[model samples]
Target: MTTASTERTARTFETIGVIGLGTMGAGIAEVFARNGFTVVGVELTEEAVERGREHLAHSTGRAVSRGKMSEEQQAEILGRIGFATDLSALADADFVVEAVVESLEVKKDLFRRLDDIVRPDAILATNTSSLPVTEIATANTRPGRVVGVHFFNPAPVQNLVEIVRTVVAEPAVLADVEGLLGRVGKNPVVCGDKAGFIANTLLFGYLNHAVSMYEGRYATREDIDAAMRFGCGYPMGPLALLDLIGLDTAYEILETMYRQGRDRLHAPAPILKQMVTAGLLGRKSGRGFYTYERADSPVVVADDRTPSTDDLPELRHDIRTVGVVGTGTMAAGIVEVFAKSGYDVLYVGRSQDKVEGVRAAIARNFDKQIQRGRATEEQKTEVLGRLSGTMSLDDLARVEIVVEAIAEDLAIKTTLFENLDEICKPGTILATTTSSLPIISLATVTSRPQDVIGMHFFNPAPIMKLVEVVSTVATDDAVAETVRALCAKVGKVAVSCGDRAGFIVNALLFPYLNDAVKMLEAHYATADDIDTAMKQGCALPMGPFELLDVVGNDVSLAIQRELYLEFREPGFAPAPLLEHLVTAGYLGRKTQRGFRDYSAR
Candidate 1:
């Protein structure tokens, strides 16, 4: 199976043999058969063979039902598949791909048998996501003939396939697998022999880190997941992704990668292993981090009646004036949000001019909301009347709480906290909205560290519901609870976490984006292909590259450096490509020319 001279060329693939017949295996067979290849689908037994055939039919049937494939096309694809219970059926296969179970012994044994049965020139490929392709290749008599074609789950739908080659693999063999993938409408990205290669190599590490955060009780699973989903625009949260990946399978993948790389971040969380022991293997087994209605179901039935806050004492209402600081978009948004909630706000900033601008911006924003019928004229007037900006530190002196959304420089923020500590009353809660900076460091500036917390808000704070209420080791339980209650009062989803760099969101997010850059740097695939694969194949809101551009490479580079410094792991070490881009002034869409050239547009 191969293509040449662009998509204009007709796909030319004759006989292709797909070993194993599970979900991934069946989908692989269907992909080839759909592209007009004579697919020899092989399994261990007649029952398994029939099951594989049914799986293929069901997959194509979905495409037809979804209007992605025509009925005639589905029938034609089914006609091309020939299922057998014997390996000898693949004697004439030009290419034989093994998508068997992820066990190395089982896969190695299958490849060894195939080495004896198939032609010497026949390309050998594996769809194993976590195992070493090199180890699988070494089991064959002609190891150079073996390569990896790691496909994402539901092979017929996902477009990306990682083409892994060992040290001894022939160049021609690598070309053949890439060609075959192209013919089957897949974008092949080449990588070295590594556990979780490319996608999972980067993806699972982040997922494991998220679990560690949850296990540490830094944040609730809901808020931690929400930070990534709403803040970063990920299609699903890390815990949900772990469920989709299968908790048992995710744990196994992390353990293997951790063993190989010896990176603590890749080390499987004990809780994940414990859950697996309890027979909660995620959606496949009907439970994991979350409960599902049934196996293979995504309809979550979370016990909303369950208590949300774990150890908070009963709330006492002693309401008073609140202060909102900073003159940026976020600060203005926050002002509007608090004012809308009927809180009298003393909006403080560096200067009167800046505060005036924030007021004007808030007015313009509310005007648009009124025009869109999202707000009533009376409500807008009442909300605006609640907000008043001031430059005097004395303005915050009378307030019960203050939220600072200043610039992200450590020196400047530390100085601001020091000033707040000296001026504000003893009971005033001081909070910072710093996203990636360590909140603990900010807490260190004040004697009342417990009173100082991280009140993180998603961008355009008035609209986004998620607000991460981060508490440092010294943060008072009372203060944390008060903020949590305040968040609910203002209609925000408040998730709590510790004072670590990136907290839950950026910690899991930036690494995935960095991995994409590394993938492109290594020439595994073009930026376009990787982006397409992620968007079309995984259903992510945006591909990593696109997201990097949106977040700005400088911001991403800063977060990456932070994670790298915190973990001190070689994999977490920021990719050289990112540094180069930053140094070259390619700061994403803000400056244009990131992974792609957006200057013209």
Candidate 2:
């Protein structure tokens, strides 16, 4: 058990009392009040009490704005809260939650006072994201009642309420808090008292890792944010989320977690510390990664505080023609994106008719755009004029780039590249849209290894914003630079990384997905429960099993093996359940059988 769980054994809080009336404080009070519990909102002064009232009012107003509540309902919820100017107001309360400044001394002193005033059975809770809950609990005679209920920002809006139980906390107190959270319509996830608890433990590591990447100049902020949002379906990217969570809060959380866990991954990026020291406290301070209009303002105003990096050298290829090698959905999409970009596209496949069928599908897509008034007939015709199909690579000799979009078979891609090397010019840029392949081996096949690079585009390339610009040691800087520039020209965000299996997205993503599978294999939870927990509990786009069905069990298994081979970590080992599914040919939506049978669909 961590400090949070330890602290819970010492404190007792009930008949809820809330000390401090900041945004978080007022939200806490409102949560308890809305659940039909009497609330005591303690503030330093009458003016501060009024401010807390305004905060509560606005929070409820937002609920009305989102159609989640009515005006009368909001008033009824507000009526239960009783505001006061003295700590003595909490004397008779059963529980007192401190939502004041994040100073450890301030919280400890407040808990010490509450310990003196409140009844023996009253529980003491802290909404501190950082700081040891144990330290606060031990400051008083009855420390067993102290618990940490870490709620995400805009507390009422976000549904997750981390019910952190300290070791000293009685089982009954923890159970009561869980029931209280459910009464307020918040899903409580129980965890031991730790710096970040469950959500922050998992979340901040990823965010801090992204910040470190930016600090190292690995990728631009825009590209980093875009990669996760577009490539991973996150509602907001890590940097943008940092801005929302506030730089100072993030730094404190990281620092606390670092001290507690001693994990380098939890260490705050130097840039984060510097930004906080500079007073760019995110949306709360009107400045962070992106500036806001004013303190506490929701509107983000543009500023030049964003970092600048040296631009990659521009790539210049000799010819203009491009050879698109494939006949699958991805191949068709790649051909369409290239053709729409006004390139002279030579879509090579085994049959001319197959190539023409893709062309016909592109035409229908263009017709749909015209029908929707998003494209003009003349523009559609112009786009179609740049596309052509061929059954042979004879016409590919004059092409500037040979993009292999064929099935992910090494032997097939090697043979095609070998043939292309014999046919194309010496300096022709060789690019592959392979999501999971070593560009080094592919580069070795050709004399112009420097020109070979990976331009891994997300599915439905035209709509997706991210393109992983991968480079091998043999790949020329100019080749990588050109691919990034081309990606930008096509309205895509490009994040460059060294050539590695899974690159960025799949490397981080597949593990989490695989872990979800393992959780199911262990019978920890049902597939539906896990999916709902991730979606409603963690705010993900889709649950793990749902994504597996869409991505296909075969593909997920292949990627897992690749990751395991590269990392050689026991944790990354492919789950036997996934292997069994693939072996059974229950490969997901395509096979119509995976975690859930989809044959009916």
Q: How accurate locally, in lDDT, is each candidate?
A: 0.84, 0.81
> Per-residue lDDT for 273-375 in model 2, tens only?
9999999888888877777789988787656754345544354654477788887777888877877777888888788778888888888888888899998
Relative to the true structure, candidate 2 reaches a TM of 0.77
- lDDT tens digits, residues 115-215, model 1? 77998778788888888888899899999989888888778878888888788999877877788888788888777887877777767777887888888
Best by TM-score: 1
Q: lDDT, candidate 2, residue 209? A: 66
Give RMSD to native, each candidate: 4.4, 6.6
Model 1, poorest ten-residue lDDT window? Answer: 4-13
CA displacement after TM-score superposition, residue 201 of candidate 1 (Å): 0.6
Candidate 1 error regions (>4 Å): 1-11, 61-74, 115-121, 138-145, 167-180, 291-321, 367-382, 422-426, 438-448, 514-538, 561-584, 593-597
Model 1 earns a TM-score of 0.86
List of clashing residue pairs for candidate 1:
218-497
